[model samples]
Target: MTTIAVVGGGISGLVAAYRLRTRLGPDARIVVLEESGRFGGKLRTVPIADGPVDVGAEAFIARRPEVPALLAELGLTDQVENPSSARPLIWAGGRLHPLPAGTLMGIPATSGSLAGLVDVDTVARIDAEPSVPLHWDRGADVSVAALVGSRFGEQVVRRSVDPLLGGVYSGLADTASVRATVPALAAALDAGATSLTEAVGRALPPPSDAPVFGTLRGGYGVLLDALAAASGAEFHAHTAGASLRRSGCRWEVDPVGEVDGVIVAVPADRAATLLAEAVPAAATQAGRIPLASSVVVALALPKEAALPDNSGILVATGEDLAAKAFTLSARKWPHLGAREVTLARASFGRFGDAAIVDADDDQLITLARADLATVSGVTDQPVAAVVQRWHGGLPQYRAGHLEIVAELEAAIAGVDGLEVAGAMLHGVGVPACVQSATTAATRLLATVAG
Candidate 1:
């Protein structure tokens, strides 16, 4: 039996190993090495007074079909449910506004529902903004905020884009690169249709029955557990990988002990130290890929809280609090849950901004409380609040990001029988990470076969 060592037992590594097992039949021996004691990495769904609440990614975007399809393939389809039955809030221009419809890339595609969303001058500029042509070099990289702001206006970036995209990338617009983050936006712009209006119009998928976003009935942890089970991958929790070096055609991965044919899927910084000898240049690029630390405060409130119905609230930066965004977990997926059990998630810190990551637990709860009260109108103290600190959660794919990623891949090729996976390359979402897992595993298998 051929042996493959899968490093990092996060969802990405587990999924990759699972696919490899499925593809290689029973003959392939797979082992997963996780630097942390836990296997889920960023995935955590803890029990609160009301029920379980996710501390990591809460929902999978609707347009991404692979995640839902994969859930079904893994027998986890029944676990999936839409995130919300109510409108979400976006904080901008000193107030929270209902996320306007017919908007894409922070630009409103139509004006009917956006009346009170923007100021008069900003509204007129947005109205007259000729479907600004999105002209970007295919091979080069650009900032998502810069691209969006340039095409629509700065207001769009400050008002619309920052609130939603900020939560996903968990980074500033200037630092968040387009190709590494939202490639579709870059692609649409390159295809030449002035303005996100035309770009989104042309790029929008044909209407389908796909739900907007879905979370697991039990929480995303179910999917993580399912992946581990399917992979039959053994993980050493609480173990920290010190380094990795390539010897001959095989790689030596040190995560407590040396393992053969290793795949390093940890953060880019760790990847740098691990792959330094085997792929020095790639290690350099990996080290250069900046990562941001963040803290997630999951506050569970009783259903009888003093607040109107809202799916969730996203707090913009420079607000009364430091949090970038928060989600009303219970409101988003009530069918799978109960009204008395509202799960509010407030995430702090983005790429290069680690102020909140080191904040004490009490501070986290306090900030979360104030933000919830200001944004959601729920001033009642949460019955239960758990703080999860991810030292390096989100990677900032700055402008010119794709070029470096390509260089890193090339450097990885110097060492054989190795592959990279996870958010460092693709994104911080569940779907994109899964997509990277599948794609990278396929390439790894083919490399080994060749």
Candidate 2:
């Protein structure tokens, strides 16, 4: 009988197990080992005010085919829900400004787009940016702050870029790599776009009528449950300290025993430990990647609590606020809005500044409410609240990240019966994780089935 072991029961691990089961038949033994007490890693959903609310990832890039296709395969097409037309606001300079348009991930294509968000001198500098000669070494990577701060000034980096990047990676532009975080902008620079302004203009995706994001109506829990059931794999929750060692042509997974194939899908650090004995080179490269911790405070307020008409509020770097951002859930999602309670989420902590994530639930919730009141003037006390702390929630894509990923992947590819998939490699979004898992499963199948 063909047997396979999947380490870590996160979305990546579960997806790989599911893909393996669909191909390897009912007789195959698929073992899923999760160190945590639960299956979902960073993608968790909990009950709040008698309804399921996603405390981790709330949505996926709708344009990405991986998630939508996965939904179809799992017969979860009806669970899909799109956000409302309400846009988001950026809180900067002690006020809320409309999120700049004509920009690629907050790197404005023109100064006009960031008029109110930045100062006059900063705007003038941006206006004059096109005339300035850029010195981008082709294929060389630098921090997003280094590139944008040099051309557009620190104001753009703090006010615009940091907020967007912080929301996505729980990181700031100072540490995020331009190539890995915003590849299209880097590609434009590599292709000799002449200046930062030109590169942003060239990299800005064409406007599309389709929604940019989507989420499951009952929260990501619905999808996770469906995947768990359809995979039909033996799940070992709260199982830890599993190690991998080469066993002839197969692989030996501690606690799970020997298996035809294995997929290590935990965080970078955990993955490093598991692969240390079997593939030292891969472990070395994986260990170099760092992770950021964060806290999410979900509040269920009375329906009368007034929030801004916008979808959410993003706080600029250095803002006098404990929370980095807030998702006015009721305003953002139409289905969430229809509920009896007005739901909102306050996100706290960022890379290199995660000490606040360790705060007590009451303290975090207090800060969340105070920040919400300051931003939207909704001071009403919450009817119900939940705090979720994700230690090592997101992996940082620092400068030269792609190179590290390349080296790690190369080392893993040389070893038979071993594969890896997670947020540490490639993009950090759910769609990217799905793609990585699918690729790993396909490659592992090719090696084991032959």
Best-performing candidate as measured by TM-score: 2
Q: What is the C-alpha lDDT of each candidate?
A: 0.74, 0.94
What value does the lDDT take at residue 170 in candidate 2? 98
Residue 205, candidate 1: how far off, in angstroms?
Answer: 3.6
lDDT of 2 by residue, 89-192 (tens): 99998999999988888999999999989999999999999999899998689999999999999999999999999999999998899999999999999988
Error of 2 at 25 (Å): 1.1
What TM-score number comes out for model 1? 0.92
At residue 155, candidate 2 shows an lDDT of 96
Q: What value of lDDT does candidate 1 attain over all alpha carbons? A: 0.74
